[model samples]
Target: MVDYIDQHRERFGVEPICRILRRAGIQIAPSSYYAAKTRPPSPRAVADQQRLEMIRRVHVDNYGVYGVRKMHAELNRRGHRIARCTVHRLMRGDGLRGVS
Candidate 1:
């Protein structure tokens, strides 16, 4: 429901959408719309957990010699869509440093 409202919000402005939903007895607040847009991850948080797991596995699989940067590159090479910072966090937490 929120997703539908958000997707069509541009086409039929915020107030109007709110009005329509309210008329249909959905009872969504204006603040709710704003909150949904600004709130942090739900699905993304779960995905990041999975991604970090993969990163940790990759790090250990490589004999714990790969640092965040290298791990990020390898993850990308292996077609995992993830951010470098996430890789950094995972590596840092595991204390896996690169051999420079």
Candidate 2:
């Protein structure tokens, strides 16, 4: 929705787009769009981005053969202190899978 607004905003403006969306049952407000544009990423989001970089580096370095278990152990061995489920979630989200 935000992306849609961004694409058409220059032509239609944020308030008009939001008003149209509200009339169409989407319930989005212009302030909501502005707030979303202005808000900073959360702490967990920052951490996950950092962890994702590390995970990608590890996965590529190990020839992409490390599944979740090995990846979790390897990250722990490197002193990352990340949870296995977090690793699984990130890997899955990024479509980084091991050769099972």
Candidate 3:
């Protein structure tokens, strides 16, 4: 929604777009759009970026043969203390897969 607003803002303006969205029951305000645009990255997002780099390095270092299970174990064994589910989520999100 924010991206949509950004794309059309120069032509239609933010308030008008927000008004239309509100009329259509989307309930977004111009302030909401501005706030979203100005807000800094969240802690979780920062952590995810750092962890993703680590995951990529580990995956590549091992020839990309590690599946979720092995990847999770390797991260933990290296003192990352990350959950298996997190490893799985990040791997899947980045389209990183392992040999079956």
Candidate 4:
């Protein structure tokens, strides 16, 4: 929704786009969008971005055959102490599915 707003905001303006979305039952406030646009990324977002880089490195270092479980284990082996679910989510986001 924010992406849609961004794509059209220059032509229609953020408030107008937000109002249209609200009328369409999406309920997104322009202030929320403005806040999001100005706010710095949260700590978790920074961590996730860092984790994503680490995940890609690990996946390539292991020949890209390591699925979520093995990738989780490998990250732990390298002293990452990250959760299995987080690894899974990151890997899935990057389309980094492992071989069976």
Q: Could you say which candidate leads in TM-score?
A: 4
**Alpha-carbon deviation at 87 in model 3, angstroms:** 1.1
Question: Predictions ranked by TM-score, top down?
Answer: 4, 2, 3, 1
Predictions in order: lDDT: 0.82, 0.97, 0.95, 0.90
Task: Give a tens-digit lDDT track for model 4, residues 2-100.
Answer: 788899988999988888888889989988998888999999999999999999998899898999989888889899989999998888888998888
Q: Please give the lDDT score for candidate 1.
A: 0.82
User: What is the alpha-carbon lDDT of model 4 when measured against the actual structure?
Assistant: 0.90
- lDDT digits (tens) for residues 1-100 of candidate 3: 9999989999999999999999999999889999999999999999999999999999999999999999999998899988888999999999999998
Superposed model 2: Cα runs more than 4 Å off: none
Q: TM-scores, in order shown? A: 0.50, 0.85, 0.85, 0.93
**Residue 48 in candidate 1 has what lDDT?**
65
Candidate 3 residues lying further than 4 Å off, grouped into runs, are none
List the RMSD of every prediction in angstroms: 11.7, 1.6, 1.6, 1.1
TM-score of 2: 0.85
- lDDT per residue (tens digit) for residues 1-100 in model 1: 6788879988998889889899999988888988988988799678867887887788779987887788888999999977888777766766668877
The Cα RMSD in angstroms, rounded to one decimal, for candidate 3 relative to the true structure is 1.6
Q: lDDT of model 4 at residue 3?
A: 84
Looking at model 2, the pairs that clash are none
